[model samples]
Target: MTAPPPEQRPDRPRRCFVIGPIGNSYAAHGSPERAAYEHHLEVFEEVISPACEKFGITALRADGIASPGDINEQICRHVIESDLVVADLSGGNPNVMYELGLRHLWGLPVIHIGEDGQLPFDIASVRTIKYQRTRTSLAGTRRRIESALAAGIQDGFELLTPARVLRAIQPGAGPAPERPPARPPGREGGGDLPGLLDDCASVEDGLDGVTGQLAAISGAIETVGTLAERSGAEALDLLQAGAPAIARLAAVSRLADALRAPAGELHALTRDFSARTAALDSGMRTALGLVEAAGPEERDEGNADFLDQLVSLDEEVRAALSRLAALSASAGRMHLLSRHLREPVRDLSGALRQLRSAVTCMGGWAAAARGLLPAAAG
Candidate 1:
């Protein structure tokens, strides 16, 4: 008989939340700044994304999450929840630093990286991968990150209990939030078979609710990704065009206004999405454990009544899990690309810079014309 697959030690689903710049639109398209930006994107996509896929990990970022919630708060939630964090500190981006700081507070391992010579001194003491954001060099970076992730998995590291960090700080400075109390088996409904079955039934009902929530979250994420995609090519168009090329400032302004972040929608979707995924994960573990444990020590492809009973339930569980995985994969991609959505709105800053430069150039020309006029008058 084919031996039953080993009763595997259950582990947390690995989630790698990435942190980095989404390439500044204001940078000249062919300039080094643009190259670096693209390089960062490539590393996350080609290098990091594939590496995560290899390990069945979910890698996400802060932008364009279809979850309806505040962006900052969503980011904070990921910072708290992610199994591993991969931060690109290129050019000492303040936002990366801030999120990295938040990750540190959890006392979990964070893999820090930056463009060589670009990481700030304050964090220099922390071990970091000083990388050259180029195709040739990214293999090394990917290896380092994957190695760190493998290490994290071995440790089964994820969220931290606040008690450890809380004690180190000033007394009464800040209180850690209380965790919901877990119920004991015998304490609930006198622990009889019928009562236990009722508890199981209630859990089954809750899983149904969580499943519906996940479905809504998936739809919302798809919508947010759609909106973010619309902003990219248009922003690139504006960035590549110069002052003389912009015949109508009003048209550009209108475009920028239209691209104004679908921030609220994204936050709502992600907030619900993230929470539901967590709940679904918990439910999945419980359900799978129950089934596996109910079967013989070495489960077989048998025609027993109990095995027959689980056939439909097993199919249902697998179907729900597949959808959940799909949602996470899509959300991870959306998270990576969503940050770039803001760049179109941010082009207003770039536009102002261009206008200032043009105005200064015109002033210089006017001065020259004035000098010529005085000479002609003389």
Candidate 2:
């Protein structure tokens, strides 16, 4: 099935707050600058504010509030309660920046705007809507801002929710942005079914890669064990047969130490990957809901297709998880092998001490034998 465009999806309308610098002086309204401020306020009240209302949004302006302290708390409360925030950064006002910072901290959906030529440096990364002081420019800005807000609203309020932001940064999960459909017109069935199949294929490939890595690590662990056994047995033989065991013991110790780093790294990677996979699993389920409730017509051509894609994606995710599990098991085995190797090293240490004692005893025996031989010969 073909998925619907994001704008057509069923979601809630937004509640927006207009935040910026407001006039401070009580008698300043008679001045030209205050008149300009009033004009700007009139544009919002007459033009921008009504657009929000027409779109079933509740628009609140930040102007009437008294002090920066009150504005700060109010902005925080509004950000938490409202669906979106429209911030005017025209004056490079410090208070505006502070309020914007609060909105960012809450992970609120913010539409930034500035008077043409008044853009700030710090907000360079974000795209901002620019308007002129004239009526025509303000009208155009209102439309653009409203359109952007509409798109955000359709994506669900969760799109700007703090949890969603946190979820996006989580490892193992694909990005929060919607995934493109699997196939284009190039393949069979107008490219829908083929896309689903492709998704499945991708999952299979990921699983295969994970499995291969697991196998490689497992093989390395086995090799370490075999090497340890061979070296340990040789060292034991040298000790029993009155040959020096230092060389054999040292070789075994060095090999064990060499294996430690890789084993540790694999273990840490396994844990991090597992955490990432869990986050992905949650996100997939959420996406599935989005696809399923996209209306009946969307389900017809895109339903089966979307389901197919989802299933394929799920399978791939599971396969990767399974591979991670296998790797984890292998890590456990490596840990056990490392412990086992340590035992042999400990035994070698004890054997070295015993060998030293024997060497000392032999010296005594040689001295007594030398004395006896000399006396007898004399």
Candidate 3:
């Protein structure tokens, strides 16, 4: 009943991209600089990779991606798209800094680590796991990294990056707080088998409803995006020209209004789903224990259906989240359009924030579920 190592497991592994100086590999063998480069590689293998694998995350460095494409594009994709990133700040490498900046701007979770005492003052405020090259230090460093990753994956990563601080100060920005925690429905312990089935059934039902809701919102956002694409100069010119411009502006406002209700609904549903999944964490851990006791065959057979449903829901949520991100960018363009449009745009932006928070919660839930379920983790 013991689970296999993550790489040997049946599920698709979560990815953690490692970003740090690739050190001059071409440096003359045994040079001091060459030693520094080799040490970075050692950190990846000794500290970072093991920590990530503890959570089924495959650790990949920039040079590790094997796909055929522009290396720059590949690195960018991994930086932006990987489930997690571990940034090594040793020596303050420029390329590493640039990639870290991108991940921060994108507002994804990143764990920073550096050589003890070598970190730059400007980034000192950021929490980073520090380590030395000695065998003893690397073991301690790995434990810290594992603990950080586990917490970030379970509770959701919400670091106050520079971009987030700026957004907080923007004219229409407001905090998007999470919904209050509620007891997870359905799944209790072994005492409540029926309740557990009911809990999962309710989640499955919600997921089904959300599929249609997301499709409808996608259509609305498409219309809103097209209207929002109008250049600021064109909008200004139209306003100067009179009635037609007023009508056009009114039309955009109406579209925004149409989007509001469905977006709000989707946000609420995701928040509720996120809450339920989070509440299930302890229950799922308990279930994992049962799986171990019951053995692989029973675990696989028992979880087959439920695991598939979760994987599907994860995909649906991810697609919608990606679309909402684009819609938010389009909505930002409306700041220049008109006064009437601003309020709706502001409301829409707030809705987007709530959605983003909910999605982040869902992400954490999905990661934990991967530990419980053997099926593709999505």
- Top candidate (lDDT): 3
Across residues 85-187, which tens digit of lDDT does each residue of candidate 2 receive? 7788887665566566545534446778888888777676677898888878888888897787677666533333322432334422332333222222243
Off by over 4 Å in 3: 1-13, 169-378
- List where candidate 2 sits over 4 angstroms from the true fold: 1-11, 29-33, 64-72, 156-378
Winner of 1 and 2 under lDDT: 2
Pairs in clash, predicted candidate 1: 67-266, 67-267, 67-268, 67-269, 67-270, 68-267, 68-268, 68-269, 69-267, 69-268
Q: How far is candidate 2 from the true structure (C-alpha RMSD, Å)?
A: 24.7
RMSD of each: 25.2, 24.7, 17.2
Model 2 Cα shift for residue 320 (angstroms):
63
Rank by lDDT, highest first.
3, 2, 1
lDDT by residue (1-378, candidate 1, tens digit) is 111121322264367788887776479999977876777778788777777777898787676367998786687677656666788877766567656655554444467777797887766766777777567778887787777667766764433322233223333344222321122223333333232123246445654564454455445445444544554455466657752434334444443344444334434443553454344333333333233322242222221222232333334334433443443343344333334334442332332233233233323323323332323336
Model 3 lDDT, residue 268, Cα: 56
Q: Per-residue CA lDDT of candidate 3, range 1-378, in tens?
A: 121322442233388899997777889998987987799889998889998888888999987888899796688778766767899998776567767765664455689999998897758999889998799999999999988977876665664454354233332243312210111233324343442233245445655655555555556555555555553345566577774865767765665565555445545554554455554443343333233333333343335555555556567667766876776776667646556456556655765665566566556545545655654433
Worst 10 residues of 3 by lDDT: 175-184
What's the lDDT for residue 276 in model 2?
A: 37
